[model samples]
Target: MNLKPLKGQHHVSAITANAQKNYEFYTNTLGMRLVKKTVNQDDTSMYHLFYADERGNPGTDLTFFEIPNAGRTYRGTDSITCTFLRVPTDDSLLYWKKRLEDHGVSHEDIRKGGTRMVLFFEDFEGQLLALISDQGNGGVKGGSPWARSPVPQEHGIIGLGPVMLTVSDLGPTEEMLTEVMGFRKKGPYRLEVNGENTVHVYETGEGGNGAEIHIIERPDLAQQRPGRGSVHHVAFRVEDEEELRRWIQKLKEQRIASSGFVERYYFKSLYFREPNGILFELATDGPGFEGDEPFEHLGEKLALPPYFEGQREQIEARIKPLNTKSP
Candidate 1:
């Protein structure tokens, strides 16, 4: 079977301390739609909150596992360092700078990086994030804007950008991205960290925010301690389950151990760790967030998978209540 390059990021999942706090930040502060409200399948006591653009498109999704007791994230090598969200233009960046400041969310001055300008910031839980100014790079094309968002449609966050991944050594992981995953090396750029670290860029498809990955080699750093505010996994997009099955078979042929095909209600997924021990997922793009509820009423109520439907009341009782009101 002939394999195709991944279209872009399907979603980036992270751990958060509280469901209500996360909901307020993403929906009120960031102005993203709370596309899905569900409980974690592995541990039914916690919530899996999905934030995305209006239609809940794959590349636009940013998700969190709400684990109130999970301690602060320990930053180190072999972890996803920062996630970039694309904005339409430099003016949009300026709008966001003021908006974040008004909300008391401290952010960095806009800085140039290769072909784009970026503004760095952190969430309430210290999860690293950035906003990249896009100059018609197709970042704004696929996503639908939330009509009820406080941010104006012209300046709203469009979709995912280059996700930064820190690795102790770049060679093996580089091979995994290029050879195994069909990404092309797009060269390197310098980033300000403890010191200046060279970050190599890789791309799939036509290469833009959604299709890019930034690899930072940091052998000097310690291994990551996974907890709240840390990225749990980065998922790449596949067209559908047919393509997903092909990827699974290919991983088997390549002797890379994977989670096999797992049904996620809205989408199917296959999980595995990269050479540097960072978790990765290949997820299908179809059977999206509208599967369980009407698009207009998404995230309005706690959604449970079919297996959990029988235990909805108990599961709901176990997890903390969330407020998904619009700001």
Candidate 2:
């Protein structure tokens, strides 16, 4: 059955053991807006925080689920290894290098990631990340940076860039991406990781920095043990609920088991694992973080869907307090 291809990267959700510190680093340090202050829909006992550009646009979102007492993440293959953010220019990389240094955040020198300049870095939890320069990039434009961001608007992150996934074998994963997911193979980039290797690039709608995924095959490594710093899932953008339903049907036709259609309050979603056991999500782009609160005061208070409203008292009493109000 013919279907519309996915637009691009939507959001990446990761695990964070300390919500307070996570907020400090992402908002105060990195200068991303705290778009939503809510709890994990499935597990309301814990917090699910969303950070993004000004309006909490789909492609800009980077979320986290707080799991207290979580263990350390063991780096290895078969993992969603790195998430990237897009900055305006090559000069932005230099600015970020200095900013990261001043914040005592460890980062690598600016270097080439594929054809674009990038600066690799880590968070307090050792979560791997990078900032990719959109110097000569086109297709899938980025989101608007928050004006109130401490990081100057010119140097602030605009949207998500390419995500890197490492797997033991590439055949099944590559086939799933091309045939079922409708991603086109862009090309490969050479790198020396464990040894000399090639990282395959794939893109979906309007192929560019925002719509690409870099896959590296590493049979030499074992499965990654995910903990506080590991990514939980990476979502691709579905235009609307209609498109999301179409995707659900397509997954069934392909005989790939999925979580079916899930109402996320803000947007609908469908969750499934790829051939390598890495979790993947398909989410709608609208009815976003603004649905519950005014755009000007987003993430200022705990927001919950109508279904969870009745249990708000119980939930709030159970979860620890973490203030996310903008000063």
Candidate 3:
């Protein structure tokens, strides 16, 4: 594919059981801004919520589809086991540790991986997450501050960090990430999970917060069962629709089936599965969260696509009501 490397992660989509709880945990606890309030396009009965930094920037988004009846997620091979959010410094990491503890959110002690320090934790629904402190590694940069957030501006999360994928075998997946996709090998490190297993790190873009992917070679685990608390897919950033179309052509040449170009309202996207069966997406960064609403009123009310406008009453009636206002 001879294209420019991806400009870090665009967003990571996951599933959650309750809309209101998901709203509170991300907005109040983690201090992220609820940037978009909408329903799932395919299933209007469910809500699709987006939370991010102050501006709802491309790489800062972490979204969820609320499905109360969806069962717990089973972690295994060919799945994104953990999603990381980048904070600026070691002091910020300490601030988060204290914050999580005060909020009764359980988290592990800060652990070292190469030059980075990682603090692992999970959301209210058991969605695996980590807060990575890069300690001035040029890889992580730029974050907008949410002035209204309880979390002070100095320690607010920057954006999406490394996504950890567990694969049955590392060879094919690693090849796909490096050769087919334009990621460069960053190095490897040991993780203390199910004993000491080595994790190979690969990165794209400028190699910081939203640019890293960690692949853990777990050949013995079972295939993951998709449900609540599991990652639906991970998206990488491209410049624009032209670049996105180029990716579609490149994937076609590689004999990989893709969803062509999907108009996602906020961003255009192309979805495909990697060799290890994990869903991957290439998305453009334009027509962002501010496309429909003004920045001051973002996520203040339910926002629907033009197609869903006709059925707004029906959709709203089916989905649960949410309150994202600060306390």
Best by TM-score: 2
How much is the lDDT of residue 139 in candidate 1? 32
Query: For residues 1-327, could you state the per-residue lDDT of candidate 1 as single tens digits?
Result: 599889989899999988888899898999998989998888898899999898789899999998888997788999999999988898889999999999999688888866788999899988989999887675325476688888898988888888999999999999999999999898788878546888899998767888999989989999989888899999999999999999999999999999999999889999999999999999998899887899889999999878789998899888878878666
Task: Give the per-residue lDDT digits (tens) of candidate 3, residues 184-295.
Answer: 9977888985458898999887886568899899888999998888999999999999999999999999998999989888889999999999999999998898878998
Candidate 2 residue runs with Cα over 4 Å from true position: 192-196
lDDT of 1: 0.88
Better of 2 and 3 by lDDT: 2
lDDT of 1 at 281: 97
Model 1: which residue pairs collide?
none
Best by lDDT: 2
What tens digits encode model 2's per-residue C-alpha lDDT throughout 18-70? Answer: 99999999998899999999999999999999999998999999999999989
For all predicted structures, in order, the TM-scores are 0.97, 0.98, 0.97
Number of backbone collisions per candidate: 0, 0, 1
Q: Return the candidate ranking by TM-score, descending.
A: 2, 1, 3
Q: Which stretches in model 1 have alpha-carbon errors above 4 Å?
A: 138-140
